[model samples]
Target: MTNLLLLALSAAAAVAPADNGGAPQQGLLPSSPWNVDYAEAECRLSRTFGAGADGYTLRIIRGANLKGVQYVVAGQSLKIRDWNHSGTLGLRPGERAYKLMVAWYRLPTGESAFQLLADDALRPDEIASTRGLVMEFDGAEPLVFAVGNLEKPLAALASCYDDLLTGWGIDPADIRNLKTAPDPLDLHTWHLYDDAWIGKAEKGKIWMSVRLDVSETGKAVGCHTLSPSGSAEVDTKVCVLSVKNARFKPAISTAGDKVKAPFILKIQIREQPATR
Candidate 1:
């Protein structure tokens, strides 16, 4: 992880200005060769840098469709001029040291989520005032990262953010209370139950299961479980939820002379109803 962080920092530091002659012309496509395509009828843009005499030229181009473009350098948001169309951004000779990328998407509903990617793996010291999700990658170039999905790399980032908060002595309740983006793992409810138990003088056995639901709004609504007797119990009372992850266990007892068996009950959470 430390090595990956050093590599990313080095890459960010290596960004340099393009030579005078190779600077992309006003009407030409952005100088970089990387491209992005949006499959859901949305606009996309990609940026790439090219080696030039002085350093490199950064080219950013619009997708087949026009979507707005914004960049964050040193934590400051800069609205790219003439970004409605393709354009070249001239990096000052020493200014290639910028290390962060903040991409903003104007969702179909006018809501937006900022996708923050760092050139360096985030160190505990680097995230002091950070208020959003953080992710780390340790692989080849054209490195990929994402957010807002349970199975994607961003999920790991969400976990890191939670850990950072905890490590800093920040109260989890306060962290959750802060106005932030909706949780991707908006689990409404989680349930765990045992089916049946069989016990003998020599051996015992048990069964267990769990269920949960996530909503479009990224909020978990209901979580519950049933005991072997088919009685409903609020599972949250016995579990601690950290961001999207949770840990829990049930109460059980065993006697030396008498073998005891336990069966898990049932657990279920309500998911968002399917759209017609």
Candidate 2:
């Protein structure tokens, strides 16, 4: 997910944050303009903070249905100590801190990075103010970016997201006044839950965000994966199983008519917890 409001931490070698040993904060100036990537599989928007550093990026990604988001951060001096490399992160526009979950990720440059996911703490619209981002990690120095309002940039992003839905064969008009979002037919799709466990990675977890194109008659007509990383076999199975087993209640319009709509699902694949 693009960090739409990520006035994030210090970054990798290319754009690492200032190494302030005992400094109180790593304050950054809004450096670059917002960049939106309309990729084949995802809609990502990003911007660089901290004096226009190449890697000082604040990227937030909205899901296909716009119900949730994911964000990524890369800090050069970030240290990891926990068994799962997980930590608590705080983001605030002014005073109230928004709590979020932070996890480790490997940047394409082979450096370590951090990311946040779809937890209740991050209510994007609530925190998406123009005040920029003030990020805090427990005992570490604060990461600050003096960015102004975000209303315009986010509007552009919403436009891009609508265009993406069209590309996936889902009508943008269908969701404008949706009385109900599509509901999953089952609690667990065994095909998907089972396929996710085969030959899983040795460590960490992967997030899979998928889009389902549901017809007015409550049938899945198309499937798309917003996250293109990880095993191709599992990716293929996601679509295959979706068509065969992924069922949903057709979205209802405010006019009391069933309408074709895009359904979104974000799932996490990780090792089953140790049950003694």
Which structure among the candidates has the greatest TM-score?
A: 2
Taken over the whole model, the C-alpha lDDT of each candidate is 0.27, 0.59
Indicate the residue-level lDDT of 232 in model 1: 24
Q: Highest lDDT: give the candidate number.
A: 2
lDDT of 1 by residue, 101-162 (tens): 44433322232223433222323432332221222122311211111112223233334444
Give me the displacement of residue 53 in model 2, in angstroms.
9.1
- Stretches off by above 4 angstroms in model 1 are 16-31, 34-36, 49-114, 117-276
Q: Write the per-residue lDDT of candidate 2 for residues 27-80, one digit (tens) a residue.
A: 565567988888655677787765432345677676544444566665443344
Lowest lDDT 10-mer window, candidate 2?
Answer: 1-10
The reply for model 2, stretches above 4 Å from the true place, is 1-26, 51-55, 80-93, 118-129, 176-189, 193-210, 214-237, 247-260, 265-276
Worst 10 residues of 1 by lDDT: 140-149
